[model samples]
Target: MKSISFPFLYLCTLTAASSVASGNHGLYDVRPFTISLSDGVPRMLERIRDTELPDAISQYPGNEAGISLETLKAFRNQWLVDFDWFKEEESLNRYHHFTAKIENLDVHFIHEKSNEPDAIPLILYHGWPGSFLEFIPLIKKLTQKAKTSTGKHVSFDVIVPSLPGFAFSSAPGANWTVDDSARVFNTLMTKVLGYKAYAVHGTDWGTGVAWGQFDGFNTSARAAHFAMLPFLPLTPEQLEAQNITLNAPLEQFEEQRYVDWSATGSGYFIEEGSKPNDIGLVLYDNPMGQLVWIGEKYIEWSDPKAGTSPSVLTHNEILRIISLYYLTKSILTSGYIYFQNPLGQTGFRYNYTRARTDAPMLFSAFKYNVHYWPRALAETVGNLVLYRNHDFGGHFPGLDNPPALIEDIREIGSYWE
Candidate 1:
């Protein structure tokens, strides 16, 4: 693999300063900011907890369908009684946080540095119904020196950004695509933070942003890693043309996954991509609606075995995830991401011509993920370097299986030469 020239990435870094007037320049006034609850937000939330949630829960008892009413009530009760948002905020604020003006919007991110001079810079992007909070658990692990499989100690200066239209960050104006996010994020790393060359990892919508950095800004985005790839698996016709074959077990698993997703999992995609605003309006102020919509995915998409386990996200963890959306009143803006980059009814139809990246890319395939792409098909999108398959874990691997994900990331960082 070719490397970025030192002149392109590092020459400007030494001289770059924060604060540029209306341009993709260095981050200005990057200071510590707390996650303050919006005005009237606490009162509204209390009203919902004391009155609305119980009425909603009582109206639909015994789980006819959707989020189990009993389970939701239990979660709501814990959120009201036990879960302390202030305490959690304090824990979240333990890491360094900052906001940068890029593309006329303030992008919020956590920049945790490693003491090791040789540490590589790695930016992590989170996807829809997810936030930078997803990457919080991995911050300490990634920033500290860790022993890789090859017994080499590696550390990273980690940056986790709240994507535009997500918590704390400014939303895009109109028709904002993932490419726009990629461009701004590239600016964040090179122009703002003065890191000429850095690695990136993403999941869900984040994969699109990661691909954007890899393809649109290759000079600055040195290497890429993905739990989710830019493109989907090949069709039977394409698979046959390539003369690639899958064994009985692999074929069965792929077939079942496709069947299951097509039958049940595709509704959210269609609704969000087509009429995002319509749904957004309905759920904007309705905290229960927002919780049911987003929280259901949190439960359904995760590893079935990860029941109230810290190894995976706990009940409080899941509640905090939804609460962030509610508190920010960003549920509407956040859903617009799907409309901006519509995957459409038929999945895997992304324009492959545009899926070009020269940077070396690594993919870690978690078995229980929503979509599964064979290694052969995944290589067509980028300069494929490493692909590893894990026995356990699902969609949100950063939170679901931090140890394995961190190890895989460290292994890829070893190939930075």
Candidate 2:
């Protein structure tokens, strides 16, 4: 492995008096920032090399049970021998980065403008375990002008922000909910960035924030797109009453997968939502521990063919995410949203009366996602104008299938009024 640097990341600071005048509510001066995980890499490498593992338990042929002991050993060996943090840092810094004061937090984001005259203002939101990094691959693709189906040339001024407490963004208060994030982000777009109207795309917990924008800020947030839906679907009986027929074989498979996930894979959801502090504190300074906790999700929730191909997320991609969390010292604060809005209690229920029918909505359903809702049932959640089903991707579509996700987002732009 290459020699590790000492200091982790360096931020170019701007004095408050020079950056923002007294009582100015807009962004305090969007300036260039660089990431150079200098100091943290050596310590993280030492920890990875010294990690202790227990004897492997006898199990099935594949990693169906969980991350096999062999997999863990391989990951450790890769970190010690092949993985390069500085190289990854350089790749990350290729995109322009900046930070601005929004609602008392230094919100970090990547703002890339298009040369096209009529470029659209679009914001992409990432969920937990994902940072602004997930959308980096899509920035160039989106910023270039391309013709839409209706002969309209469309390009975007893309804005990818780190959700509060995720990467470079400051952590939120304990009582913060997705609604609070929605308000702050809306302010970032309409007030700080001076965009009167914008569109949005979200996945995972980001879907919740996008929902808030659709429901509450519909005037400014004109159109929205989601890779995941935040609300639950109607029961089978309810769907039957509405004369909706589900494809039997596919429904069976989806149901079984959902049941299996709820039974075996919801432990993290329970822990993170109920006791975020415990897990967050335990893994705060432990790089290997963060890897195990987040790596399992990247492996299981992604497409089955992820690691075998470059198109989908690979082990190296997973390592980069874990490294980001560890170096930022944000593992603890990142889980705070789970505590603020318990999954089952707040956003999980199905309610027809409270749907976001104000704005035009689009959805891209990756077949392997842990949860599933047929287009028939999904359309009821909002004014769903487009629902495209994809057979190749999974939870993190931005990484699992960037080309497909990019196309879907462009299609949404065509539908934007």
Candidate 3:
């Protein structure tokens, strides 16, 4: 085996954080080492079929957004039959792809740079119930906008990586957490992609990973930003140690997260965080199950208070995300990631006393979710270069409101430049 010197290894470590953060994005001059997906995806599907669902219908807690006879038939007819993985695969494969062996597991990512080489690099992370597919439309906007906004003289290099046990990547071999996933992403940027500086934006689970990556990462990853910073109701322990109280103004952000956690998260949390393999086996097998499970996020993540009768996350976008997970057969492995994940540091940052990063953050949230009212909390955190609140959208804004999402990205890209 070849050996790397101290200085060289250190350089790679530092550059990793600043580089474009996904697979097959043309960040590396050398081709990404390929990994196997054929055997894994099919096996997952078979397992999903073998597992059985209860005779009684299962629906969301409290509000039963029951699938009507008509809707059920439609889902079974179209999603079960006509949903085409081949076409989606072809569309996704148009971008450069890369794979590399990291910690004895295969990692998959999309790494694409525009015509301009020095363009600022942006890494987009996907949360649970979604895959790299969520960023497809945004990738088009960011890459194209960077050029036009910059007079075609420069552009943005985009990296979108599937987290460990997601899509083409292998599940954790032993105990893992969001932080471990963050470490792998950091390694991809430095060791494989040869980048020393960059920025990251994540939603859902990706946001957790991004938080941890920036928390302890000993590199120049610039700054980390997220949509959901769910810290509600100062825990008893936090009170004991810090003597902090959740006053009227302080409780707004934390209270809502706790309310949602109690109301909607009971089932999803128990299954994914604990007995994942049981139901995950079924999701892996049945495409119908895949769609339902992945599609549930729209209802789950979208604030029920949005006033809109239906979720702002359009059906086409919802289907697109579910299709990726279903086609990849990553349902089981993705769930396994949650199982292996434990709170190395409680997963709850709870660091209100300390400023996270000096880098400016562009926190664009909607009034529907807790992200809406963060002005007070924003003051407690690091410098908020821009915090815009919209009356629409929810957890996944890109899917909820693509136009506004695009505008935010373009504006931030220009601001940072």
Cα lDDT computed for each candidate against the true fold: 0.74, 0.77, 0.59
Q: Write the per-residue lDDT of candidate 1 for residues 1-417, one digit (tens) a residue.
A: 011224334234323421111223323434344566746358646755655544455665654457887777787788778877777777876666666667778788888777777788899999978998889878888888877677777889888999999988989998788888998888788877778788999998898898888877888788888998766555556676877666657454654565566678768878988898899998887777777898888777677665434355778888788878878778999988888775632222454543455668888877667777667767777778888876566778887778778888887666775
> Which numbered prediction scores highest in TM-score against the true structure?
2
Q: Which lDDT value does model 3 have at 393? A: 66
For residues 1-417, what per-residue lDDT tens digits would candidate 2 score against the true structure?
Answer: 121122222122223212211222323544446776668899999888888887666655357777777887888888788889899999887776666677777788787777776777888999888888888879998989887656677888888999999988889877888888999889878877678788889888888888788888988888888987777544556667988887766654554556668779878878988899899999998998998888888888888888554355878888889999999988999988788877654455455434544677888877667777777777777888887887777788889888888887887666777
Off by over 4 Å in 1: 1-29, 38-41, 50-64, 234-242, 248-255, 307-310, 344-349, 353-357
The order by descending TM-score is 2, 1, 3
Cα lDDT for residue 21, model 1?
A: 19
Please identify model 2 stretches exceeding 4 Å from their true place: 1-29, 59-64, 233-243, 248-252, 308-310, 344-346, 352-357
Candidate 3 per-residue C-alpha lDDT over 55-90 given as tens digits, one digit per residue, 9 for 90 to 100: 444455333553343444454455434544455555
What CA root-mean-square deviation does each model show from the true structure? 6.6, 5.1, 7.5
Models 1 onward score TM values of 0.86, 0.89, 0.74
Q: lDDT of candidate 2 vs native?
A: 0.77
**Model 3 clash tally?**
19
